[model samples]
Target chain A: MINCKALTKKYGNFVAVNELTFQVQAGEVLGFLGPNGAGKTTTMRILAGFLSPTAGKASVCGFDVETQSTEAKRKIGYLPEGAPSYPEMTSRSFLEFIADSRKISISNRQRRLEEVHELLQLGTVLDQKIDTLSKGFRRRVGLAQAILHDPEVLILDEPTDGLDPNQKHEVRRLINRMSERKIIIISTHLLEEVDAVCNRAIIISDGKILADDSPKNLESKSKFHNAVSVKLLNSMNLNIVDSAINSLPEVASTRIDENNNSLIAFPTKGKTPLEAITKLGAAEGWDFSELHVESGRLDEVFRSITGGTAR
Target chain B: MNGVSAVMRRELRSYFSTPLAYVFIVIFLVLSGWFTFNFGNFYNGGQASLAPFFNYHPWLYLFLVPALSMRLWAEERKTGTIELLLTLPLEMWESVTGKFLASWLFTSMALFLTFPIWITVNYLGDPDNGVILAAYMGSLLMAGGFLAVGSFISATTNNQVIAFILTVVVCFVFLLAGFQPMLSPLVGWVPQTIIDSIASLSFLTHFSSISKGVIDLRDIVYFALLISTFLYANVLVLNMKRGE
Candidate 1:
């Protein structure tokens, strides 16, 4: 539903987004990950038609963002970073205004407003001015405005930044619920949010895309992919277990976690360490307390791809 | 068109929802009344004309109109609502025209509230109601001219105070351009035609002609062109902000 080609945006000598290109399809939620000043928001703003790119092109639902901005914008529901709204207006009034601007029919406007109000749980504070609402409520109000018209594309910049854990979870769930019908692109620094809500993830750093793949695929790039760790019920001869586990053809290497008295084993290519560990436990009478397979760590991969440097 | 109306509705509501609309109207009424009675000598003028009342509009709007126009875009920029506004499926001209109309309509409301002055003149003696109507129209149009300039200046900055100050200074220059003192300095250094053009650009010159019940096509066209030129610049400035 969205395509960007060699999209470059510069502020004088500073390149905010440089030759960044990506595509998103319907029924896909793409998580945009990057550090501060990594061009995530800049790219999203370009896609939302709020900022013009210095070079290259971007389109939403086949409408060029720069040339056909009105058509492109009509398909988009954008929640800008910080989710700013008119402070003096009530949430209902603000949403109504947004609904009107979106060209919602007068007959359907009230129903649409009520729907978003209910969806975002904005009923209690619907009549209160936005400036008087709490941070979470204000963010919800922003979300309500973005989704009020039910546009096909949703570009949310840090949709869950200031929310509490429960609010974050609710927002993630909302995104998940809407993922099947819309092309949702969310830019956030929270790795866990990508895991929970995104079907695809792109990590950007210093105005360039560092990695783009499914969260699982990106996590699998970590060194810990397919690694297994086993904990013994009693602190017995850890070397014997380590040696026995290391002798298997599937085992690539073994390391002892002395603090936990556990043996962590790395598997050979295309190998399953669980089979070897289970067999060894059965044959050697190795009493196992905890045994599990790692899905690989996303944070490690994120840090490595982003260079683990403070922007 | 829907976008324009949506923006206009919201902007008009914003003025009323806060203390801005009421406070502005009260101050405008008081000042116009005070100026007409004290400096204008409306009661003492035996002719029973609204000349004193209409005469103060240009000077009154010089300070008051900026206060209304300063917040048109500066507040949106400062509060970051400009992002939300610009991202919507609305055109730049729609938003600019919408905001300008809202402020102009609000100013018209304030102008309308001075009806008692019109009533007072008619009650005290026979007055030219045609001239009074013409003056109201002229005052509203002059407000538009001042507001368009102020709104354009507002779009160039994010600070409301700076927007207010700059708008006042610009409007002041435009108002003073036709005055003899200001024109005298330019007469010797500049060509006669240039000096004539500068004086022709003055709000006072055009407004005075209309308020005197002389609604020339040129004066009306001047105010219309002034408003259109500044509003066009407002849209351009907003577009430049998006580029930045």
Candidate 2:
């Protein structure tokens, strides 16, 4: 497990991370969500042992980050924000050097290198300088270095930030493949990413965590949670249909989207109004299609929890 | 130890990957040869000793060593690779020492490549090869001292030119501290003990003794201490800088 107690970091008078506490266990993929400079990167850096915290303590697998730095670092793999590396080195040489620094036994070093190369699909560019590779390739190279040692804890900052859609999918799949046995923390501004990969999400703002919960539970905080949405075939009698649906006590309000010929009814409380809406549509003989209830909107929840600070 | 060698090997490979290493070695060789022949009068100095050759090393290294060490940390900082490097599972000192040793070895390699002069000196007349070897060792140690200072300065800034200039200025002070002309000005006001102590800290004071064919443990200790002192400072500064 990775643990942090009141972890904080200050740059002169600016507090980058403020008294944050959290714990992550194996098989947990934690998503760090925040606006830029919201201390997402700062928190990750402190955990990765790149920057020292001003106060508080952090540990990985029971090893204190500050006191047993090498031991703590040995159990972690970190991919920094930009995936910076030696531009002069070829992918093969750089990985070899990392393996040597890690002191992987020579007998299996080649095997591990080959595995990473194939996993990242870096065979074509293994001999090319990192500077010559594309942004996606460079990012993959950084990922390869991070997982070369198969560390227990993985801290990745914006792991899929600049990738194409396909590349992003591949990277997310890879993360999911590894999430079953390791502790992973990925920071991203992509709200859907939290829904896609993160088991739990922490929404922070101004260096303070505002909300922390599983994605589903967090999404429940959204006003759209459990709201029934239906696509109308025509805008004819839209106001009548909206008013009739809004008349029900369980249905708090209704919104009509003329652009898409759609109308949505929000629940008054923790109520499932989808069946009631379907019965009303049938009894009223309304022209509608694609009637469904939204579990929640993560973007709406993120915006609400972060108080319009979501970037 | 493995960590040190891993870093060292990567550092050495980086130097060779660019034209900088070749250009530096060529310049180092040309300048040393010019100083030894045109200025030191190696051909006309009625002596079989490589004294003329060894005498010019301190001056040659004054510029070359700083040039070699300037990019050690500054480039890493500029490129943002220092974060990846420092976060690796190794002691901070291991990285510092690895980088220092790689540059020191590079300088040593360039110095040894001047072996034709050593061969020429031996070819001309009977000369004590033992003294020459000691002089080479002294020169290598002095270069190490210069490199250590450069490494610390490099960690202080992301600008390589600034690192190079500051290292040159600091190494110059160490080089001239024991010069008789520079020291004579302080003869009246400074106490004799203070004057001697300052002179003892000079690169010239320690390196000259070793280059004179005397392998004194005191001089060796001086270079070792100087190297470690600056390298330790490098670690401390790097810890605070964090690629700033």
Instruction: Please name the candidate that would achieve the greatest lDDT relative to the true structure.
Output: 1
Score each candidate by Cα lDDT: 0.92, 0.91
Kindly list the per-residue Cα lDDT of model 1 for residues B47-143, writing each as its tens digit.
8999999899998999999999999999998998998999999999999999999999999999999999999899999999999999999999999
True contacts kept of each: 0.87, 0.73
User: B1-244, model 2: which lDDT tens digit per residue?
Assistant: 3999999999999999989889999999999989899989888988898888888888888898889899999999899898899889989999999999999999988998999999898899988898999999999999999999999999899999999999999999899998887789899999999998888889987888898899999999999999999999999998876422
**lDDT for A198 (candidate 1):** 95
Give the interface RMSD values of the models in order. 1.2, 2.3
Model 1 regions more than 4 Å off: A233-264, A268-270, A278-287, A309-311
DockQ of 1: 0.75
Residue B59, candidate 2: how far off, in angstroms?
2.0
Residue pairs in clash, model 2: none
Candidate 2 C-alpha lDDT tens digits along A1-311 = 99999998888889899999999999999999988989999899889888989999999999999889899999999999999989989999999999999888988899999999999999999999999999999999999999999999999999997899999999999999999999999999998888889999999888999999999999898788999998887655777888899998779988888788788899999887998988888898898867898998988888877778442
